[model samples]
Target: MAATLNEIYNARSIALIGASQDPNKAGYQVLKLLLDEGYEGKVYPVHPKEPEILGRKCYPSILDIPDAVDVMVVAVSAKVVINVMKQAEQRGDVKGAVVLSAGFAETGVPELVEAEAELVRIAKRAGIRVFGPNCIGMAYPALKLNTGFAPGIKLIEGSAAYVSQSGAFGGALLMFAGDQPCPQGFAKFGHIGNMCDVSNLELIEAFNNDPSVSVTGAYMEAVKDGRELMRIAAASEKPNLILKVGRSSLGAAAAMSHTGSLAGSDKVYDGAFKQCGIVRMDTVEDMTDGMKAVASLPKPKGNRVCVLTEAGGMGIVSMDTIDKTDLVLASIAGDTLAKLEETLPSMAMICKPDGYIDMTAAVSPEQQAESLRLVLADPGVDAVLLMGLPPIFRDAKDTAERISPVAKEFDKPVAVCFMRGESMAEGRRHFEENGIMTFDTPERAVKALETLYRAAFRNGHPLEDLPPAPRHHLVEKAVAQGRNLLEPEAVSLLADNGIPTVDHAFATSSEEAQDAAERFGGPVVLKVVSPDVIHKSDAGGVKVNIRSRSEMADAYDAMMSEVASRVPGADIHGAMIVPLAEPGTEIIIGMVRDPQFGPTIMFGLGGIFVEVFKDVSFRVAPFNEEVALDMIKETKAFELLGGVRGETARDVGSLVDLLVKVSRMAATQPEISEIDLNPVRIYERGLAVLDARIILSCGN
Candidate 1:
């Protein structure tokens, strides 16, 4: 990977294999681009057919070139790439090779795949890095370098560096960057074709460590080393904007065929991105929006945003957008209101969406700047959104420039939304040029502000360290027996681990069930335990709240009969007679091993709503109490836990502790495949696991 980056950056002398004199050929275009783009490097065209091409002495082969080349760009056929590479490797100074040839594994051609693999192996042996077998190559704008056949265009030089797997996509992004009116930033856009060695993770890590780069963006089809990427993203302080294509099933299949990638489940990607703190965007526009926001906006103190707009409708829209995100609309502080009162009319309403400021009456830049300054000074406002009407302000550009310095003075992120059409383009450009984030629409501005707030706040509040998990007795026994834990076994394991479970006893027969129910006391619960039936409730294998021994005996028989009827071929492992747990707030605590982020803990409203409502929050495993508490509070069900209506708030602290413990367990035990503790009853005093299941790795 070091070799790859160096080869791309410091290629003082390059050998272009299959170089042609014909102007229309890709080889000719590549050489022309290098010269046109002001690449200071020397060029050696390797062509067996021509003695001289493009006003330069052409070598028959790389071996024949008198001078050693720093990098080799192979544009020959796939079959000839290896041969060319072998010749290039013979040169002592040949450090890296970018194979622009196609017909690799992407075509699903067996022979070509082998040829590509051989190219990788030869390059590896030669200690030379390979870029792509089917790629658009790379460009370094700051250095004025262009290596592939892609067109020569002015690449934006700033902080954001972009990497993609698709050559066409990378080229398109470069072209878009050149065309779009974006903030100045250094960008390293490249394609990772047939990533045999160099991968997305390596590039991200490089950019993250690079002093020139302040932010990183990626358009990845699939992660080659997901764990490595997650680790890098999680540890890096720079904001990362990732747009992962092929999120849907159809798109995943298409991506698989296009790049030979495994675009895993969307849920897994969501969990992984959340855990790593990587801002995931759905489209290219969103990616740019996020990047611009990060580049221009100041780090917000918190997620609370205060909107001060001239148009009430735009303010309402901004409020709606804020509600959609994690950002809260802060109440106006008294000092802020007082400041605004002196500047504005008596009838002005200075609330959260403080749009009562008369923009029509104030045509002066000073008035607009004063309005903005007053809003930003509010102690409760962490960030401010200003919706500017270009037609109303006489000097829109002056107003934008004036507002920028005042916003900086207050040390707050002030985003401007130009409500007018192309007429406001000048004003928008002025604001953007002055480092004030300006968006075309209110929603876009709000989104950028929200992302800025999230990135800023996320930096300080790191995931907390988790508590020690309870030892699972049944899990240990099951590990010895080489079996998955059913509900009863899982419950016993939870009890062993220090997690409270409802008191239960295994019964082999109806008579035993009756006896166990008598011993357990009133309101017994009967559940038929079977190795084959993981979802007992769904299979009619569970019977809850049996008051008497007679009821228990009948329920045990009925549950067994029902389970047998429903499953038909399931082998019942007898019944579990337990004391019925008192009704309380039901919550779920589960662990899923995310492919990219490793183990992740999930918390949400438990019971059937866990699936139906899908109100869940996730954090990477090994989280501390603080992180666990944040995850719990982040959920919509937090209101319920805080005693909604007449209900008493459950012991949320206990739940957070339990989550931390579970996360630690997941992190420590690699063999534990999954942990599902549904309906973890949260009482005012404590919590109890009503049902649990632990699925261990098959190898374990």
Candidate 2:
């Protein structure tokens, strides 16, 4: 099958459904822009009454046209959109439809929503792919096609593509981009209006294969299909940038464990981005700045960065910002430091902390170029960030002309922060036109360098796009009989998934409890087995350290009475008696079905304070052993697990194996909705699941 977007964007002939001669209407603007921009494809204007529009023959309807149309541009009102589509579907030759009409599902009206659904059914029946029912449409600058009504702007040709969920904001940004003195050009621009049909995922999928697109960026308020997006982004050959909103609406799932309360949706999205190797931008400014930087510069060879500045204050600010990012200051080599000392004036400071140099405001443009050349040549430096605040005596444009050529000579990435605002416009423009990433602030420039390093690292070491595994066997019976699972059952679930649980047995009566304890031949713990008691300790349902059979029986009787008094009318089930587990570093491993992203696994410090000190990390599931290790390293508990203050290293290998198994179970089993394995003690050579709680999907 043909690429749906390719058919629409590169159509041989187009039928403009609501083309008009009136200047005020969007119909007129869309047609005029297409014709004026010199779209190579044939245009057939379709209007109700006009015989001719914009010097082209106008048709009453698509059916009346004699020739076949490759694409249909629908610019009609929502009231008659169904009728227009019905008529076009009869033609059967239209391959794609750009439905630029409004008044569909976005209005929250029942009638329009029904009409939108009907429109989708009609298009699919005729084998026609739909773009949008409430969008401004798309623009392909490289192909000279204007299927959108964004007016008065002509986008220059470049290798970047942008997709937006908000139509008005998207078009305005594109328009502003096209109007700049040295605008960042784009290959394609699309707006997903209501996402009735095609979305950012489809567009990104199409762009991933297209050779003309080098980088892709989007302005998304939300995503409907995060799984597909994650898959596409991880496998992408080029860099992907996203400005995802909804940060202020951060909230966690209202489920039954620390996993649900700590794994906020926004933080999960952050983890997903990192997992898929995507560059996340925070604002429109970031989107534009990031796109330009990635499209223009070669990625850094490594994370080590060197900062060169002509002013002391700018150098200080640049070094401070670099410390906050993954990019580290390079340790300038001895040869390079000696060269800098001999070449610079006495006012210059050389490598105070590391890979930073401050040549005072009095340095000439020639000296600036020489310093950049020497720093970039150092084997320790992977990239260079140059900053300058031109004084009244120094010429900004002259400095740009001198440094731009030298910056380009090295294959390493270069990000320049040229301050003093409009006074340095000439210098900034010089750098931009010469293909150097330039920013107005030191922080922004460092961020660009960081993007380069991250992209390069991911490309060299790509992650596996693991698919969902077969359903785990334990999930079958758990869903059928669901609730806060009993201790024996929950522990069985973990053991079945290749995890080790302490030796345990279930007993209904006091004599049975004593017999079960004696079989262990050591101290044991007794925990009540009742679905009603969600937190056993809080409900007085737990008693530990029973050395004798008499002590076990007495403990069991007293616990039952205490639980009955605390939780009135609670169903009193029997007790699970298990041998006492050896103490070690306690950690939590959890799985919760995220409403949007699905099956996010978490790891953190555990044992009672799991909720209080929420030092946790999350990863969307279906990952491999390497990624599982990444999840563990992301938390502060990693240091403790490795041993702190001369303590022996716990069994990190055993914990990693457990995490991988839990991840597999989470990915394949849809019925096991949430799981909490709190205080899974990690011993020197092995680990044990001390307690487990799994909440099933249904069983109300």
Candidate 3:
């Protein structure tokens, strides 16, 4: 059981169990931070040896304290932590605890692990939520409570709540708050180490509910329940920025050793995060900076942004970078263009109707601010990127002040890039202090706006909540059979789930293969059907475009012989023959059961494109037609499907329908672990599943 966030953060009385007078000890720092931060809550220092500490009488234990303690801070040795927690548990008034000690389960020692477990058991029995047996702890700037041991740090007042898995990282982020520009400082900071009781999801939910906390940032190595996190993220309107590490094999192992957390499949995490509208950040710097920007600005209504720069080269650079992202150069509105043309100097050029607003170096800070004000007011533009304005001119501070009021007036986002200047630091500080997001480069400013636009779009059009998939009996029957499904069986299962599959007939022998090919009366594709074989092509078990009995017979014999040589002990389960469909673009639809996020669906250009380009897009299961369409468009090769080079467009609606059905099947059928429908040819009006391989879970 976990204690409510209110009990932990808004506690009226807090007790520091091992409060010390020594300057070197963490306990001493914790007490000093609480007092120095101007915490309004009652503080009790429980130390047996000290008569008084920091001008306050020290109690022997939590029980000895005269008043009730809402939260207890335990910074003691591993040997005595259990006893301290037990005493707090017996006190009954302690609603929650922040344990600042190590050498527990993370040490991988049995006795220490048992000791931590016992501490948790006592806390749970006593109805007290615990933060960590090994963590830096929590800091609530709004309450002026600093329970962690980072010295000489002043908490910032901001709307973004950051919770980190690593205590040291959390401390660093908090310390670096002076560099991050926000209207206020951070709403709160937490280091949820080990998460034996209170989890990251709970902390996220708490912040999500806080009206003041507009955005939440997390540095999570792993999550205990990905589904719950997704659910909470989906339900909350607040944007979440997450920097999820431990993606590579080496990083995963390191994360496990560091926190005893299993960093699950990175692909699944990506899909789930996108599905739930949580913005996935690439690095801690990105997360921290992005959260600051997102928390301050209004959600851009669209991805269209207009770049304003006094320097022509900076404008060009900003436009080039914006082109690479999901953002687009917005078309300037006629009225806004007219206003710019009237107000600008003769040398100024409103050259691009879409994207860049070129106000030459001759333009003053006042003219620049006016141009920005008009552009931000334009209906076509959702956001504006001010590049190299104040930095180039000597009046950086005055320019920032001039632009600040206009930026705050508009509902859209405004980002500024200080390319270079002697007053770079002072100008940025001024702009940030006045509520404008400032970046060092044009590219970074554009990148921040792109992130804001994406978060806005996702939040507006959220992922659909699909009902539980209807029972799939075909899948149940296949799982009952103790082996992976053959191609024919996999195709049948797909068809049963309303996903279109090619018509096919199975044959056990060469003569039967010939008969089956003859039945098709045209060129047919023949593939070896073996549950034991995963990659049939690698084993030479596939032969395509067989037109006659002789060819079919030769292909069958060659396939069997090749399989025998390639995969010696594999069991042969006959062959499947289907009519060769018209030549068209190929698409690959796949599903993999991720350990943490359950099923995830993938779509990409099939055939060699999948292998050579590796351009694929993934989304969590239960996705709808709209989501499937987005997945299809996310691929780099989407232009090929959209009738590139004067080619006729394939039936994209049919492809989308197929993707949705496959997603449903994956979500509903836990027995099926992986499904690969490769080279699903898309013709003028229809598509055919050329091949399918579905592997059942061994656990089933």
Candidate 4:
């Protein structure tokens, strides 16, 4: 990865390719913004038609420019972009080029894609790093250099660097950040148009090493190299916040059209994010707010919090919100409680939030200040939440000023939530001006606190090595057969990989079925096995819990009759008889090839609840134990697996092990298209696969 925009903030000069005299064009804006931002570096505008842009002399081409340009901004048509890039490569002094044009692989046009590829090849050969093929350009606020068409009058000087795939979305977020009370800064918003050579992962790695950037945030439609992104994010010392769009089918389609990216399933992305310890947010607001909170707030020693509120109702709401955030309300210590009692009348209760603070007690500024001091001094409290203070008391400004110094003494985070409109406005302004974090609502305050809390706990766990891929006995034959494996065959294949499956034998006739049942055990299960009868239960092709040979024969006959009636054209493979397996718990583990993300593994509660509850978690193939455990815990089934109502806990350890094995198998074998292990029975001592289906990839 090359140095990020922040690392090269002191670049001596920049060359503007396709510079134009027309102020309305993006090229003109690029030249104008650089000048307006007070970039100290010399600016060279390369244009064939214009001799001067914004009163600065413009050269006809890069070859004509006397001084070496550190960075070149290519804002030209797609047809001429290649030419501009070629000229940039020939320049010995140019270190990097930002391609601000759009026509690339995103158009899904063959010529444009080929052209973009050639541009990358040229840059690589010349040792010139390329930023984008379709991007809005770049900006470095610290140096007052803006290479993009978008102006930066609203941008405030801060320590966070942002990157995005969508130029408009980046601009919108920058605009939104301008309105926020906290001072937000961006080294540059690199709109990585089509990510021809430079990718989000590379940028993240660069930012991770950049000293100026204290925190990093990204808004991505899709990740080109998910594995690399995970690695960088996991290793980053600074907080990495991500707001990924295109999780839904409709959104994924839009992302594909916008960036020529294949946005993967939401579940897969979620699992990857969790494993990487990236702070994931749903909206831009959350992303901005989360970044601000993580950057500005002091880390809480613990989740314990003390809520100080004037109104009882607001206190209750605050407590409820706190509970949802997984933070514990600190119990009022005896000395702190005594100090509060001394400051207030008997009517004022000083317990937690709901504890007493009399509203009509004619509170004085000195008394209010003293009460806040007592709360801050409490050894039991790690943080304090002051809520519902009306502006009428002292204009909220004076009150905040008086309490700010005392709150700082304890070195603890203090969040304020005002219910009244005027009070909130006054309080927010005062707190922000004084660098004291405040929120409009208790929920928002709790959310901010939660981000910090999670970041603290997210001490990156070491990535465990995944077990080697399991060997399957059925892959070669199934591929040769050019057909999906039946349940019996699939089970046999799984059994070969050390997966436990019930002992069973294929019976060609009713007499054979009875003989097989007696050979296996007296009590056995009979199921009509055929490739066409995928859903045996739906077709009434399965019978279980048979006690005798006669019962087994009857079940065999009934299963055959039901299959024949259900699908008259289907060929009967014959009945399978196995000893009745002890049923403890049921779970499902399956695999399907995702068009964008390749092999994906799914785990959930087995049977009817699988669809009804939609309780499933997914992870991309070749996952370690930690990743597999994260997937298992993501589903509501985790509660059941943990043992509800005195039930013995299921073998979650074994289940995760099995999932890891399956994921590796999927990753190693391209011939396997889909693998379904439904209703795998979990016993007290062991596990048994009751059914399976393996669908080979087409032409395998």
Using TM-score as the measure, which candidate wins?
2
Q: Could you list the CA RMSD of all candidates, in the order they appear?
A: 4.7, 2.7, 4.0, 4.4
> How well does each candidate superpose onto the true structure, as a TM-score?
0.88, 0.93, 0.92, 0.88
Model 4 lDDT per residue over 314-359, tens place: 7777777887775887877788788888886566656735333433
Q: Name the best candidate (by lDDT).
A: 2
Which ranges of candidate 2 are over 4 A from the true structure? 1-3, 20-24, 51-57, 64-68, 151-153, 172-181, 247-253, 459-484
Global fold similarity of model 2 (TM-score)? 0.93
lDDT of 3 by residue, 312-346 (tens): 88888887887788898888877888889887888
The runs of at least 3 residues in candidate 4 whose Cα sits more than 4 Å from the true structure, single-residue gaps closed, are: 1-10, 151-155, 249-264, 311-317, 344-349, 352-380, 418-430, 459-471, 595-598, 621-629, 667-670, 698-700
- Candidate lDDT (C-alpha), each: 0.74, 0.82, 0.80, 0.73
| lDDT (Cα, tens digit) per residue for candidate 1, span 41-67 | 889888998988778889898998887
Clash count list over all predictions: 10, 0, 6, 3
- Whole-structure CA lDDT of model 3: 0.80
lDDT (tens digit, per residue) of candidate 2 on 1-700: 3237777777888899999888988788889998988988899999989999989999998888899898888898988789888987898788888888999898889988898999988887888878888887788887788788765557678888888887777786677565443677888888878787788788877877788888888888888867777888888888888888886322433445678878877778877787787788877767776777777788777999988888777777777878887889999999999999988888888898788888777778998899999998999999998998878677788889999999989998888888737788888888888888688788888887887777667621233445655644455555555545567888887787778888899999999999998999999999988877778899999999999999998999999999998888887779999889877999999888777678888899999878888888877887777777877898888999889999999998998888888877777767677888988999999998888888777732
TM-score of 1: 0.88
Candidate 1: list runs displaced more than 4 Å: 1-7, 22-25, 51-54, 149-153, 180-183, 248-264, 304-313, 330-358, 376-381, 392-410, 419-422, 460-482
Order the candidates by lDDT, highest first: 2, 3, 1, 4
List residue ranges in candidate 3 displaced over 4 A: 1-3, 180-184, 249-264, 338-342, 389-393, 419-422, 460-481
